[model samples]
Target: MPASIIEVPVVDPPLAAIGTSDGDEAARIQARLIELGFWVSGADGDYGLTTRQAVMAFQKYMGFNDPDGKVDEPTAAALTNMDLRPVSRANSGTLVEIDKGKQLLYFVIDGKTEWVLNASTGNGQSYTEPDQNTPGEIISGVSLTPSGLHNVNRERPEGWWEGDLGEIYRPKYFVGGVAVHGSNSIPNYPASHGCVRVSVPAMDWIWESGIMPMDSPVWVHDGA
Candidate 1:
């Protein structure tokens, strides 16, 4: 070794991205995430993979853009003081309220949020599906989840229920070819063909619990 040569070690920067993953701050954040309905099954103050995923889900539903799952100052503040809520003009009854703007699904029974789940709705894009009006042909329509009052007309307890555009799990059809179902991929934005996409576990719960039964009212709207 040369006496004149000085070897300096490189230092890494702190993980100061967003949403604290560990520490008291992270624990508080996790508690808030659970309160705000972001599903933190393992919220124990330790910022691990589960906490990160829960934070990501919160960011997605809250309409914040932190793809890295770090809660920035603004995001943390917003999480603490979030005011975005699903609004239903309906007087009172058992119904499922879906907010496409916020990508959230609220299982409301008699005017209470029984279960809150991260959801995705229509992406307002172009899509093609088999035409029921014509034989051996397909039809094109805008990929959209219509915002209106509907009834739970049908349901499919089977998994991976096939659709012309894609597949859904344990779908409960509300309108014509549109349902609030389960999907493995529920992003932070609207990405469904024309249905509401919830978590697979959530879908199973909906079915097993029979929350939204047949003929139950379903209200789909957004104030954003």
Candidate 2:
């Protein structure tokens, strides 16, 4: 008699991306992200803007290219087995690290990057814009995200603020006239004038959670 052959089963990879509304899949992804300390607002079974932004942040943290917030096979696989997390440059302290080169922000707790976010820093371009502080006065300077050690000096806890350049949401001022604020447009690369821009929801979370309190050390570096 001939030997019997055993059948092997094939498994399919997860498929979810921007605009995908599969509740189960979306919830799974969101839960995984939250478990990894990613800020997804909540796992509400909706792959919406907040979820997409969180996915983008995860991709950037993993050093993936073209982080388009697509949870395809590769992205899902990587997410499933992800072990690497951003390391804090500071030896030991609770601080916020702004990586200019990576355009990523890290919430470091005791030298460990507990959470990460997609951030848009300065674009390094010269510009002249109306200064909100002074009427009919224009300010001229380079749009540069200054790299140095600083601390959170002040913060606007509620509502949008009319900054020198434009409206910033819940800005946490660190350096002189520079802050880590919220914006609707936080591109992959640097785009802000001088402030570090994150999502509005993220800024809200920062304030509501009291993660970055007053005088919290903020280290801005080029990651070089």
Candidate 3:
């Protein structure tokens, strides 16, 4: 048997339907874009300019004849092949909680502590520039490790805090900009710009243990 070559037929953009109106449809589109390596602001149901732009970019990458910002039949067919489900614990191992306040990374299995390590988080108490009066604060809300259940959304070979730090090779976990990654130097307390800092050994352990599977659940408590 030979692999079938998918021939994308020419089709006009469905103007009758400008964009997705359903929340689930938007989520699917957003997930498809993300899987195709396009960063999306949010998966809200509104198919605004950003989503359209992302769609065009995806089409261009696929070598389409016209990378128009419209979801044509070809685009729809390509998207249908993607797995856009949100990350879930059911597909991964136990939850691993990193307590920024306590400076500890706890690996919990079946509601029991399996391993622990000294970690560091965004020093919500430093200034990036000495002349500036405002202290360097981690972006609030989404950037801040919310005190609730979330998953290890994605990982990147390169760190997202590109401009902040000088050029350096490092892997970052995209659980927000905060990641469980290695640091050349670890300060006594919270020091990262916003990410969760782990020792080289600790990072290797987590990666090898498969604790933080894609979309693995994470909980950040305020120690209340």
Candidate 4:
């Protein structure tokens, strides 16, 4: 099937928060967002936090400043003309490519981004956590998601994986102490404690769909 050609009419600038007044238009926008791999269920033309979060995720994938999940004219246009294969360097094989600068995660198979999810990585700040083994002694590390190559070495199914920093939902561990897991909050910014965070629904879908199976290569790069 070919990509759908969506023609969204140009509308007046948002007088308040930007959202859909028309149910049909909202459905069309939701369809495009889901097709591009942002996790959003029930595109029954209802626009709410779920749709807004999906839009924020879409904006992150497109390397746009997503302060609000408003469906602007340009954003709608880009979604309509989305590129299936967004990442250029990883031209072959299956890999999890994370554009840290873009704050987006791409599940690539055969050079195409099967799914694009909005993610939050380390915020480059530092925090102190007491040692697991030694009491009264703390260990400190900068809250930075390391950029490089990694492989999915472990996965936790249907449970929360506790860590020194925090707990992750259904985590798929790639690097030491760093995995892509589900979270209740997936803000459109870098706010993790050195791990990558996706929405709970997105993570569940990834696991259910086997998007990041064991030994899958995960490439973290700044350039999208």
User: In lDDT terms, which candidate is top?
Assistant: 2
Point out the higher-scoring one by lDDT: 2 or 3: 2
| Model 3 TM-score, all chains together | 0.45
Off by over 4 Å in 2: 1-19
Residue-level lDDT of model 2, residues 110-177, one tens digit each, is 66667778899999999998999789999999998889999999888888978889999999999888
Global lDDT of each candidate: 0.69, 0.80, 0.52, 0.74
Query: Which candidate leads the pack in TM-score?
Result: 2
Q: For residues 48-91, write the lDDT of model 4, one tens digit per residue.
A: 75677778877766668554678887677667666553443566
Prediction 2 TM-score vs. true: 0.87
Best of the two (1, 3) by lDDT: 1
Rank by lDDT, highest first.
2, 4, 1, 3
> Taking the tens digit of each residue's C-alpha lDDT, what string does model 3 give over 38-146?
4344577667655664565445444566555567666786656543311212223477666554555566655544444445566664443322223463323323444
Which residue pairs collide, candidate 2? none
Best-to-worst ranking by TM-score: 2, 4, 1, 3
